[model samples]
Target: MVNILPAKEIYLQGNEHALLLLHSFTSHTRDMKKVAAKLHEEGYTCYAPLYRGHGNAPEQLLQYNVYDWWQDVMNAYQFLLDEGYQKISVIGISIGGIFTLKLAQLEQLEQIIVLSVPVEKEPEQLKQRIMDYAYNYKNIEGKSALQISNEIEPFTNMPLDSFIAFQHFIKDTMLHLNKITIPIAIFYGERDEDVYAQSAETIYQQVQSSKKKLKGFANSKHLMTLGRDQEDIMKEMMEFLRMNNGDLTQ
Candidate 1:
């Protein structure tokens, strides 16, 4: 049986549409709080979902996979639909962004905003180093490098299976990018050491959406939304949402 993660809703007045926000692996909804607050200020009702095994305990991650994450998104989308929200937009960060791209192919979303998505993984040595650090490092607070490394560490100590599953999701999702017709805005950090820079370029080149754009932050790392250029990123997101009928600016 698949366990779909539950979502936490934050309603902001005056927003006619609903926005579904997904965070990166092992992260909670707090990852999108700043972005959600900005969107809320712009009149959007934000629904941030905590993926299965995340924001609770690390051990729970063993039961979750990419499909469970997708299920959580579908459940949240249906909830918004039942709540009378017709226009919907999705914003995902890191692994969440990868799921956003996968969800876009389903044709239910009107617009998508992805930040620092991991469409391509780094080399084997780098991957191993990341896994090792995540497994060994405990005090992550205030350590920017450790925090960034932990984000790509597969969410648990187990390996090979999860890595293969992640790769499958990447390949399968990229193959179906042509099916996504919604307006998409992809943001990346040029200094990101986790995902490949070419991942963004490949997405830009392959996505079938005519209204797609790729934005890169030269100074930021993998956590673009939380980095120094956060304000600029938020501004760009607001502009994109307004242009795409996301109801936040409308």
Candidate 2:
């Protein structure tokens, strides 16, 4: 049997300054749910869009590339801009953070926040594990193999094409890091299992933005938004936005 869970978009209306929240690769809008709620309470309109091929059947994910996901992010931002929101900020987690950095090179916005972004290439061992799981999905001990696999990692499997696309995306995004002059804040987990701990500092050093901050959180893993320092992370994001006057012009 298949697990046909519903994946919904999140939109909260508040002030003029809107925030576009992006989830990690293979993750649904649910990853940004809590953060969106907090930012909404802080009087900022927020949107969390579900990326293409995500929150669906695992095989369907193979149909998309990193550019497809970036298009989804652009659509969400355009929706806000069309709705008369002038001041816009973007907050991203993991792969979402990579996308945010990519967008920083392309667009001029209010500010950006990248949490636990991978500045370097992903390990081949990890990619192999995902490919292995995809190959053995039916043999897994579960009713819904895809769903069960997603419980372990956001995506049940990683297709070779998508993996390659991610590598290219990272390489391309890094090449233009000097183009980002907008205020940016980065957060990293000291004990992150997926990304290296030094990634935050690496990004902090690469960007030409004078207004930048690198923060490391203790006792948090790859899922920094959902970890022990969740509240603290939210507070820092809120403070960062406010410092940029994101609370004004409402």
Candidate 3:
């Protein structure tokens, strides 16, 4: 068994259910604070787990792998269970979305909201660009106001081994997609240059869940939750949770 790693939580007392929010790669729990606040107002407890090696010293990230991150999610889920949360849903952004999907495979989740999940292996050109950016051969650009806050000024340089491990995680997750049985809502940006929009489309088509919805943000980018249409994204999330009776509003 993998060792349980430490995580942070933002709890908003509500009914018996809660929403677990997971942030993207290299991001801190602060990345989901705004969303957590809004969800709190609507009556749901939001627990945002800071993935291992994120929101801290960059070097710490080098010591971890995707399994370590997954272990953190497991620990968070157990925490919620111990707290008497009977029904739980998850909302994850980017790499967090990948972890949410993996969680769905292991647990009987009420609902899942995935934003900008990277389902495909990085394309050659994109991989090269990332490498260049990491090595200081190119500058990292921010496309929206959300990006401005979430973006690392110099862009955190990722270890090559970690990047390769991510590819494995994606591959393993996709192979297990058929095992996910929860209601799923996926959001993708049509203009997203980071993760291919096709990946979201594939997930929408491939998942066997009877209840699933896919929405595209035409003017947004990879960071859909942090981009121009974030409010819309949140609105859709609220509606989905309500429809499933998973919303804390009720």
Superposition error at 130 for model 1 (Å): 8.8
Error of 3 at 114 (Å): 0.4
lDDT against the true structure, per candidate, is 0.74, 0.80, 0.75
- For model 1 the local lDDT of residue 206 reads 81
Candidate 3 ranges with C-alpha deviation above 4 Å: 1-9, 122-159, 246-250
Quote the positional error of residue 67 for candidate 1 in Å: 1.6
Clashes per candidate, residues 3 or more apart or on different chains: 0, 0, 0
lDDT ranking, best first: 2, 3, 1
Q: For residues 1-250, what per-residue lDDT tens digits would candidate 3 score against the true structure?
A: 1232334557677767788898876566765777898887788888887777765544455577767888898898898999988899999988788889988998878999998887866534334434333332112232344544344443343435656767888889988988987789989888886455778888888888999999898878877777788899889988998888733544
- Determine which window of 10 residues in candidate 1 has minimal summed lDDT: 134-143
lDDT of 2: 0.80
Better of 1 and 2 by TM-score: 2
List the candidates ranked by TM-score, beginning with the highest: 2, 1, 3
On lDDT, the candidate that comes out on top is 2
The better-scoring model by lDDT among 2 and 3 is: 2
lDDT of 1 by residue, 81-181 (tens): 88888878899998788888887887488799998876665334323633444443333333466564566455434556655666677778888878888
RMSD of 1: 6.3
